[model samples]
Target: MTEKQFTIVRELDAPRETVWRAWTDPAIAAQWWHPHGLVTPRDSVHVDLREGGSYAYTMVEEATGDSWPTGGTYLEVREPERLRFTWGNPGDAEGEAPVLTVELRELEGGRTEMIFHVLGIDEDRASEQSVFQGWTEAFEELDDALVAAR
Candidate 1:
């Protein structure tokens, strides 16, 4: 079976710079990195936005208080345009984890079109769908954060 690859595109009302800042800035990212109902503490968010740099964040479930830590190393970083990174748990070996590529395109009237491509997923369709759903929710939170930041 082939590894799964998926892409999610979102049209955000904010400009590319604002959306980029929300993604690359740790404090801003923590505000909406997780799905709905989960909270990522600002202090727990760390970002080194550059090639070969790394980022990590901890998200706590509101009801269960469970914490999940996610970390990744940057492969390519293009300011306000693109970012490619390896994503997985903090201890994951480099190259063993999945890769995420995000592209931001500035549209007319200050809107931004963002593409999130996830690669190297080895899972069933249902599992992939769940991942997609989670990201959808997270994107919703991201939109809210962008509005609030304005």
Candidate 2:
């Protein structure tokens, strides 16, 4: 995959089960699933978490009273093995938003491999360094979540 629109692989120093829960369980997801310092209020999140399942949550700024809605559908969910989903940013204008798919694989010694492939975005948009930077930060948060969960 090229830098414009490609995959991100991060090896987490945690078991597959722990990492899996962080991605599947709503409570676990909220802990590390957002922009830094954003609060995931109770009852503000729901994750069906399966093939054909849907998920949604709002990121609220306690200091500013701002909330942004985001959601997506699961294309596949293989427990402790893999997860594929249609990642969408509802805040964007209709038809301009992108869709992404993710894959998770297990590694030796209680570690995990996470892969994220963002598709359905324009080449120019996909190539944007800023957007990918967000994904990098998001993955780092995921890493933190794994560590904290353990």
Q: Best lDDT goes to which candidate? A: 1
Give the best candidate by TM-score. 1
Q: What does candidate 1 score on TM?
A: 0.93
Off by over 4 Å in 1: 122-129
lDDT tens readout by residue for model 1, 101-143: 9999999999999999999863334653476777788899999
Instruction: After superposing candidate 2 on the true structure, give the runs of residues whose Cα lies further than 4 Å from its correct spot.
Output: 1-4, 90-97, 122-129
The clash tally of candidate 2 reads 0
Predicted candidate 2 versus true structure: per-residue lDDT over 37-121, tens digit per residue: 4666646678997777878877777789788777777777778777776665655553454567666677888787777777764
Q: What's the TM-score of every candidate structure?
A: 0.93, 0.79
In candidate 1, residue 61 scores what lDDT?
A: 95
User: Alpha-carbon error at 97 in model 1, in Å?
Assistant: 0.6
Compared with the true structure, the alpha-carbon lDDT of candidate 2 equals 0.71
**CA lDDT of each prediction against the hidden true structure:** 0.89, 0.71
